[model samples]
Target: MLNQIEAFQPLNGASRERYVEDLIFRFEANDTTSTEKKRAILMILCGPYAYVMIRSLLTYRPLNEVTFKEIASKIKEHLNPAT
Candidate 1:
């Protein structure tokens, strides 16, 4: 199933929202309901650029203490282009 989901490409002109949607789809496909596992999987598969971004965004607290929603929101917010 790992083969089905590609690593997120935040630094490659990819649509962050679309990639997030795809990731959620993959999660649903695999019946992955645990937010802890979701966060872990996201950290593993979100690529190096995103890992750095997430780390910076979450510096106020330990990564393991964050919820998936917080991580998702932070990633989405951080990757959005300035208008």
Candidate 2:
């Protein structure tokens, strides 16, 4: 799992550490049966870094122009890209 994250690299130090910690905690818990719940947990765990990244992406855009579906799609693409 670390390998999966390391592939992305260049993350801010504090953010990266928090991400790693959260990843481990989630992996260990492994209790969620719903994909949506699991994904939400992961995103919440990402915290400020994920918040900042998504906010920047939606900058100058109205709330109606932004959607969790779009954010989820981007997250899925980034975290589980096809090789």
* Winning candidate number (lDDT): 1
For residues 3-75, could you state the per-residue lDDT of candidate 1 as single tens digits? 4666667656666667777788888889999999998998888778778888999997999999888988887
Give each model a TM-score.
Answer: 0.82, 0.35
Ten-residue stretch with the least lDDT total in model 1: 2-11
Report the Cα lDDT for residue 21, model 1.
73
Q: Residue-wise lDDT of candidate 2 within 1-83, one digit each (tens)?
A: 42243322325555444554555455556654555554455555455657666556557875345544565555545545689
RMSD of each: 2.0, 7.9
Report the error of model 1 at residue 78, Å.
Answer: 1.4
TM-score of 1: 0.82
